[model samples]
Target chain A: MSTQSVAHDQPHASGGKYVQIAVILFVLTALEVALFEVSHEAGPTGFGALLASHFVVILLALSALKFWFVAMFYMHLKFDLKVLRYVFASSLLIAVVVISALFVLFTYNRTLWWATGVWK
Target chain B: MTAAVLDHDSADAHEEHPTSLRIDSRKLAIWTFIGSECLFFAALITTFVIYRNSHATGPGPKDVFEVPLVTAGTAVLLFSSFFVVMALNGAQEGNRKKLLLWLSLTVLCGCFFVGMQVYEFTGFMHKGMGYSTNLFATSFFTLTGFHGTHVAIGTLWLGTLLKDAYKGRIPPNKALNLEIAALYWHFVDVVWIIIFPVVYLMSLFAK
Candidate 1:
């Protein structure tokens, strides 16, 4: 789509604000890359549960930061129509449920992979 | 949320708020669509991350992804977002020439990004990594390839807009449309952020 597609609902003319947001996005990207480069050892048997907990926490934190950026800026959910937010939030909640269910089903049973002894 | 920003130039011209600006309308609808797409991409990312540790055969992420190239591409895509923002500013002020320039710049960046991607994919193939290589390969290709397709689509969209810029058919009133396109572009970039970490960086975690 071109600039002529939407009626200009330009944000506040404060150019600094966008520069600020862009800076934030750039920094976050760097941080994510850095996080991935940093690794930690987890449970072999002794600290297994503790390791899992730590990993889950770290992953959730990174994911949450990404979520906040997209929701706040790109989607304009931060300042614009609040009702529109429910759409994003609701869909995400549903997807999370479905994916989690898939993971649980895979872990708890064997129904999903009626493989050709090869691939799904 | 001032009356001024919402109602800037009340006397300039007024029409029904286009579907673009109306909440939970077109923009929101697209967002919901994107949300689902996020999960779609996320599924691919998660699969790649989980199975990466178990790669029975094929070029894994570390064997392929040239970080310098990808990082530069990332910067290109990010800066393109900025150009689109400038383009929007130009359009709001009714500056077609400047708008066209920035839009073209954004499109150029998209093309460059895609070019880098083609090269990257080719390089990966050269590393003996293909889609059928293994589960990790499947997920890697599906995930990044999916995003690559989006970039290609976005590039085409940008080209069409650029062509319209030349044809002088791009509506002057559709600043929101520029915004919509920019939003989608940025969202695509955002998806890469998630994937870069989950797929490219932690690729060693794949077995």
Candidate 2:
């Protein structure tokens, strides 16, 4: 985890952090583009397949990092109330459960989606 | 940056960073919206993944993609996230001029990305791949198309915000609402941060 910086007292960043973030974003984009180009071909050692798996993991991690930064800094979550954190966390957990259940049920051809669709 | 209002009032300075809520109402609301949006985006991503592998038109991810173009577009959108942070920076100090300037830059970045998207969509259409084409067609059009729509909306909203800033309504003192708006804008950019590689870049391998 990166250090938790204060959101007060000090002068705010004038996008001094931007160049670093842009560098990372560009690197990741290049890697994604490269991986996409290579995946369509059949390699001797299934390199494309192996690389695709790794690519997905890396992309997800990067995306999660983006989420954390925006939530912490841009959203000002870091300097806010602890109770508010709990509220958001609990809501997120419930939403994940509900969405996951729905996805699984629908993908599995469960009757729930049908019934739900009927109501819709 | 909404914390600026609390800056002058010494007693309020101890209150919190964003006075949008007595506590952290803005952060909480924004996160909850993000939580819901995850599913909204997930549906599109899932559809893309499911169909991406099965495009039968002989035209596929490799056939239509200009990797460099999509990659550059991704770069533009991701970099815009930084500009949003810049806006946050200005808001933090209650610097109205800086805030508006940075916000304007962010919206410009957004519009540029949207322009690239339109160009790419048309480029694909010219290749005999379009909304009416194949499995890849449906998935590609749906995912990227929704993302483009979002960028457009975000640009419009940010423009409205800049106008607000011009009228001095976004006074450095009360920056929470703008911060929340910036937060939402960042989330939109972050979503593209994921989608670019997942939907566009990864497809380069899709032969």
- Assess chain B of each prediction and give its TM-score: 0.83, 0.85
Q: Per-residue lDDT tens digits of candidate 1, residues A18-59?
A: 567667767766765554444433335545445443543555
lDDT of 2 by residue, B1-207 (tens): 222222223233434343444433444555566666767787777778767866777578878878678777777777777777777678767788788888888889888988998898888888888796898888889888887887887787777777877887765545655666676677677678767767766666433
Model 2 lDDT at residue A79: 60
Candidate with best lDDT: 2
Please give the range of 10 consecutive residues that has the lowest summed lDDT in model 2 chain A: A1-10
Which parts of model 2 are misplaced by more than 4 Å? Answer: A1-19, A34-53, A82-120, B1-21, B24-27
Q: On residues B67-143, what C-alpha lDDT tens digit does candidate 1 reach at each position? A: 67887787787777767767766765768897899899999999999999889888878888887887777777787
Expressed as tens digits, the lDDT of each residue in A1-120 for candidate 2 is: 000122322333336655565566566556555665565453646787777657667666666666566555544456655554565556556655765676676667734555766767
For model 1 the local lDDT of residue B176 reads 56
Instruction: Name the runs in model 1 displaced over 4 angstroms.
Output: A1-13, A37-60, A108-120, B1-25, B205-207
Candidate 1 residue-wise lDDT at B75? 73
